[model samples]
Target chain A: MNSRREFLKLAMAGSTAAVAAPAAASAQAKPKRWGMLVDLRKCIGCQACTVACTIENDVPEGQHRTAVPVYELDGPNGPSQAVLPRLCNHCDEPPCIPVCPVNATFKTEEGAVVVDAEQCVACGYCVQACPYEARFINHKTGVADKCTFCVHRTSVGLLPACVETCVGNARVFGDLNDPESEIRKLMAQHETKGLRPEFKTGPNVYYIGLDDRLASTVAVGGGARDLRQGLETSAHGEV
Target chain B: MPAVDLMSFDHEAVWRPWAVAYFLLVGTGAGAALLLAYARLVRIAEAKGALIVAASFALASGLPLLADLHQPARFMHFYLGSAPGSIMWWGSWFLPLFIVSTLLLAFMTGRRGNAPMCGGERMLTMIVGALALCILGYTAGEMSVVAARPVWNTLGFPVVLILTALMSGAGATMIIDSLNGEKGEGRYMLVVTGAATLVAFGLWMLTDTNLSTLAADYAPVGLFGGFIIAGVVVPVVLAVSAKASLLLRGVSGALAVFGALAFRWSTFNGAQLMSKTETAFYGHEAALSQDALRTLAGSAGLLILSLIFVTLLINLLAVRASKQTQA
Candidate 1:
């Protein structure tokens, strides 16, 4: 009984310290910067990541959780193509978060923008607010749903469904805060670009070998289009 | 005409007509309800007429929305969950509340005996007022969410919707009050009508100056041209002036209704034109590319003609109904 009391006392002290230490340390710790890097040069458009993502998440048909927009570029000699795997950019300054009247959607400390499915009323407002078409109404739940970046898998130290199944090993994921991480190393080595950077969404996903010329082809306020020369150059260079 | 691309024929792509119809109907309903609620609060004699108009508007708004639904049978799904995050969800809940409260207020007032309003009755009326404001605000927010379309993506949208509803409601009350031979209702009508017009004009001018292209798409020829002058400025001027007779009041009320409908229609048309133009002119062409201009002209023509026809029909019916009620 004495030993039990001592154990209980130690456990209480441990719990109090655990709560207090984080509160103190959080003030000192720099905000964690999270990001993703895609090596487009290595991406073969095999679509292994796309299928894997759907199966793992049970994404609905006709509405994709993630989409690979295939841009066909006409060239001097022949037709070439470049594929951009479009998903939630998980923007640093998320537009969708502020518009939710009920605070059903919000950003996490890890910088992932998540929606509370229970709180969502399935108004389709967030779907329209997303400039990149990242969100879609889950037909089953009748609520706004999108890529969670495999939060469940990532928490368990497992790769995202997409990253795990990427055939070309094009997608690299890691804690961007860790200097030793592969993502950090690759980002350090390469100049990266993001879609609609002018919107200043501060997207975490970065692309290497992003055809700047092709990106420029997207007219201001106009939606997507195909660029012939840029795609040919990118495809030829990659092969 | 450009060869019609049948493969990409999106039923969802044709959003303007539906959006305009929805906005106009909802605006009218919200406006009529506010007028009735205010009349009841103030213990006005024309409260019964206003209540009837409010109920009519609410019922009219529901028709278009029901028609717009792909699966009308599943309409009850909106009420199944208290989805506060969605404007439509909140609107669905609030609209019914407003309708029920308005019915109860109408019932209480209809009783011939001199019975004082119960505490529950007063509380319910207050709740209806608050709910009506919410519905107005939510409708505006719903429109503003279409960020890709610059015309609909303004901070002014929700505020404009509220003001428009108030103006529409006030205009509706004036017409009903005049026909019913209520004394001094015309002055109240004139004041609200003038204020509503000024607010509508001020908001349009502010929006025009800030977003020039959006203004061009909406008011095209100038402020004096298109629906603004015909629907808002003219009606307001007529309603305010001393020469404004009962005939003039009827004309002004008709104009106000027309203006509200036209404004909504123009907004819907402008958004569609802007998107189509942007899609056609992308990177390779000038901002005002020939193809973009053509699309704009075609869309504007279609929208304006449709408005004229619909307005004429609604006004003819309304005038006839007012005459019969008076007789």
Candidate 2:
């Protein structure tokens, strides 16, 4: 009888804790939905953001957490260099999430996609499933790594390393949920675009002055791709 | 084109040769298990080779799969967390159960006397057969759902994968029978499945919108030269023409399995070599690392060791039965 009474009291306490948890959560300000906006017009192609990201994330050599791909378009006024700074889109319908066999990768409450190194089995299934080619197996960590939107700094009321170091003020990082945030205001003022709209990934990262011609079809041959291929081929004794 | 890339790095391949080995071994084992089920139902003593191949290959398939992962030791994460949504996670559960069922069936087959199989043994074969199909389905399904890869996501891809597995499985059965100094009926099985595999490939190349667009340029030499000519055409021709020679039959068996491996290499590696963002192919060459070589050797060694175990077990059962008869 005494045991049963104690059990009932414990069950009541547990239910009360569950009920109180959400109430406590609601009392605090709602979590921020972080997103990035890149204004191509402002970008001077200095690659300062890329350098800062590499140093900040400790990404190994010959790999990138973020990089700008420059394309030379054959315009009516002759050829011109165009820059498109690329990183993880942190898609609302992220393909990388469900494909993780261990549930090691997930969208944070603040809307950043992140990988838990400890839980990752490094099967590379998620890497294969990612449409953006954003994720990779980090050689040093031996786990899937991608741009986490620099969550460690963002959570502590600081800007991401890339955004902080951006020379042209091109990369904008802010809370999408907050109405008065700079990203939201910028998004409202301009006709924004996202890469690979055909994929319907619903990318949170918006861009201003994104060239429509550079959407999908890029001409074959020549680039860092060829240079990297030569290095890789030589390394593997294919040369 | 309106634009030329001044600078961009091509995406690198994540799945390697070890993944291909795992798929090949498991598919062969699953196919052999299906054949073993048919043989058990009909009491075809000639298909004893199928039973051995099914158990041994299934047992040997897991190592390469684990080795494919960067964190081979961390596979327990698959079961430690619940992930019903992931096909690979579902495979983690299905694979071990399939292996156990195949092994259990082999054990039961050994213990059963020369008298026809009882109801219990017949039921066991059905269970093993069901699990074998699940393994095949899960493996193919896991690859199919990745819509990111245009070549892999096609409806025809799974059909080709399944047909080739069946073809390889039939070939392995013929190999075991030929080695056992017998003319088995697996030649006809090989012919039909091998032909079906070619038909599936042709259909895939012709029908799949993405593959049809890319097939002319993207299909590497391995598919046409290695898989179709050497793997299917040569072995299939031998299987059809040389009906009496057991040595020729064994040769066909080896070639069929090799063809299946070639198909996987051609498709898995070939599709990955294509740049998702561009029209060009990535420069990828298989570098046989020490780790990959060790895994390959380990799988072969494990198969031979498993074969010895099964041989001794059946022989022991036969000896015990003879002693009981004398008593």
lDDT for each candidate structure = 0.58, 0.79
Error of 1 at A107 (Å): 7.1
Summarize candidate 1's per-residue lDDT along B1-327 as a digit string, tens digits: 121111111111233244456566567657766665676677544454455555555545654555444334556666664556556667777767765666555554444223455677666666666767777877887767666555566766555556666666666656665675543243365356546556755675665543454454333432334446776677778777735477677677667766676566555544443322112211122224464355435434543453344334344555665566666
lDDT of 1 at A164: 78
iRMS of every model, one decimal?
12.9, 3.8
Please give fnat for model 1: 0.06
The candidate maximizing TM-score is 2
Per-prediction DockQ:
0.07, 0.34
TM-score of each: 0.60, 0.89
Tell me, by lDDT, which candidate is best: 2
Query: What shift in Å separates residue A91 of candidate 2 from its native position after superposition?
Result: 1.0
